[model samples]
Target chain A: MDIAYFPGCSLHAMAHEYDTSTRLVCQRLGINLYEVPDWNCCGATAAHSLDHHLSVGLSSRNLALVKDMNLKQMTTPCAGCFNRLKTASVELKQNDDLTAEIEKLAGISLTGAKEVEVAHTLQVIMEAVGMEGIKEQVIKPLNGMKLAAYSGCLITRPRAIAQFDDPEQPVALDHLLQALGAQPVHWSHKAECCGGGFAASDTDIVVDLGGQVLEAARQAGAEAIVAACPMCQTNLDTRQRAIEDERGIKYNLPIVYFTQLMGLAFSYSPRQMGLNRLLTSPTTLLRSRGLS
Target chain B: MSADFYKPMRLNEIDSSLQEEIKKVCDINVELCMECGKCTGGCSNAHIFDYTPRKIVQLVKLGAEKTLLSMDALWTCVSCQLCVDRCPSQINIPHIMDYIREKAHRQGVKTRRINVELFHDLMLNSIRKTGRVAEAPLMLNFNLRSRQYMKDAVLGGRMFLKGKLSPFSPVVKDIDHVRRLFKKIADNREG
Candidate 1:
């Protein structure tokens, strides 16, 4: 019924559309999202790269805050944040000293640390709002639009930490897209890295990796790419033109949030879901399909 | 995926302290790596990294701290963990890479692919000040600082036009606590 939500840094800014759509979609499902009070950065790729303690501290702090909210279930839409939070939870269970230290900082003992569990929004959607629950609520069937469901790196990698879906070949996002009447395209590089964390400083890597994913989707004849993480959406949407220019190919692929597509199926307005915020501009594809 | 580097490493010159630090931080049994390049072969960013996953662990086990810390290989690892999943030894290659990155960042080693280090610091600086990242300014500042202006300028312009680049990024009320949290952790005051 109620769950602690940690949108992380991206959802509030570059990924605000993701947050908007996720919130609206969750609301339609009668789910309440109590955002973790005073949630800080998850200390993503940067924090962990700089200091292990800081990364753990940053992520574990949010988990501790979720406990403060009297909730054991925590969810984040960002794959990066989800992985960091899940890592903290899984690591805390491994080392008693680290758990004790985190407890000391949180002012709670190990026994009292109410088994905080972290879930990506994809898993949350799949488990909390099953396919049947979702199918019943769809007003727009998506009219069988072809889309590539991209889960990105962190959602289903490092097997032990993120055990939600298969690391190599995840079909949860594909299944959800299918439930909404969208044809989930079968692409080999669907679960590949999007060079998400390196988008800014190392744009080249992001270009290469993101380009590869987009190229694969294009090869599979996908009209758009559906992603559960903001970073994947950012990379897929922001760098498409450049990849096209460099590779001498044409892929006018519109990268969209899974929730944004869900919002469309739920008959939410474009403005309500921040649909216009997508950098790649889904106008043509959505217009062609009579979606928006 | 250019495999053009040929640097021979001798096993006789291992530094115990560095090995201990890497082992302690990463919590990996590097000795179990059977020279199986599966980790390196499975790496997504090995094309961009100088020290591939298996080589990173091999270097850490060899205690080649100077060589490992000198390159920007650590930052290139997006932590996809494909290597870890494929490793028969189950070596936590990404964690080891994270350890190397933490060390590189601490030592302030600036070398090839150094822009990634700038990116990491700028992101941390943004987060430390705002409690969350302001992407527009973060990207702008990162590009300006790293001199990568031409890469995403047009894309950013389009994003701004689309209303994706928000000018106002909220700073958490507990800004002081965030500042302290970062400071204490960086100063090695916390576990």
Candidate 2:
């Protein structure tokens, strides 16, 4: 279960919780996460927008680095990084001409690491730690803790590229939540865009679209929302207050990363799961229910 | 990356007057258009707009100002950014759309239903405070403004009943950075 890990930029800074929780949960689940040697940014949102070839070239350099490491697989925690790497890999794998051009530009050669899977942390968890194992591991079992799973656009979109799950309706996270003995509420906007990078340049659309997803989750009776992407976490949990103020209604739902919840159900403390980093406290609810 | 993939079915070039205005706003070279139509295909509003991505680029290239601005199609974009994400040419069609829509708004050419513009105001207001988009409050404001609050009244009440939406503001870590960014964008618009 050992794999090369790329934490990307945000995981070390703003999303320290995701980084810490990922390490801790992998430890508990008997999986190994070795940081990719001297890894760099995946050229996530910015590189892709500014120049197509430059973005692919930059991503190819990272991939070529991994290929040089001789690693067969790499697991990424951030959804953006995952998408970037996978997109580049898909392009390189499918378009030989593109690979040759990018290699020329990047000054590196990719030996086409066959089936060298580039996967999100969630997919790795789902595959390595099956639902049955997860259910058995649940010491706290978020019992009756209603949750709406937000599977934003990246991991599931541009259908031809990612193919992680269903494009329109994804249920991988939902299935995982239900197996963990919690109620996973149904919502239609699960696959909607969270306006990731646009949040910086176009704030208005980000809130408006993100709000719709949150509202739908709320309507479906979720006590909190679970997401795999940190951007979604930032939008739903951190910016939730402004959404409230702008519209003059309250949405106090706790936003938790899937791994954090896994850590909790596996008998880990808030400290172990980095729950303190969250703006909305779900730990208190867990403690009140005598689970923490 | 094949530039020939999107052959414009109609309106290969825009009118000159509209071209100058669009170029002034976008300021980026629309001539680098590669004719990819990725923008049109991924646009969330394309379903509602007559100008597909190919058509929009064609219009911009031909400088079709009167037709582009006069149409209500520009206002329907949610700006979710799918087109921007997929565009191989790296053209920010949404930004172009925004500039066009803003121009239309200034000229008093608006929709009978102003959902996108209203959403924009609420969204910007939310981001100014939190540095990100918050859902519950934005929805409430959007619903209230659109006078469709009753549509999701039960859901809203249920959320309140379950403490999903709260009255207290959540802590934002970098309020100043957010304020500065918002102000800079706003100032740029006015100038």
Each model's lDDT: 0.81, 0.68
True contacts kept of 2: 0.01
TM-scores for chain A, candidates in order? 0.96, 0.95
For candidate 1, the docking band is: medium
Worst 10 residues of 1 chain A by lDDT: A105-114
Off by over 4 Å in 1: A101-114, B1-20, B148-151, B189-191
For residues A1-292, write the lDDT of model 2, one tens digit per residue: 7888888755755566788888988887877998875555565554443235544654565566676667778988888878878878887787777777665544456665433668888888888987987887788887877888888877776555566777557888998888777888888778777667544334555567677777888899888889898878876765676577776778887888898888888888877787776776776677766676
lDDT of 1 by residue, B77-143 (tens): 7878899899998888777777777766666677677777787888889878988888788778877
Per-residue lDDT over A1-292 for candidate 1, one digit per residue giving the tens place of the 0 to 100 score: 8999999888987788899899989989878899999988888888877777667767776777788888989999999999988988888878887876655544434443438988998898898888988998999889889999998889998789998889989999998998899999889888789987877777778789988998899889999998888888888788778788888897888888999999999998776778788766788888787876
Query: TM-score (chain B) for model 1?
Result: 0.85
C-alpha-based local distance difference test score of model 1: 0.81
**Window of ten residues with lowest summed lDDT in model 1 chain B:** B1-10
Runs in model 2 lying further than 4 Å from the true structure: A112-115, B1-191
TM-score of 2: 0.66
DockQ of each: 0.65, 0.05
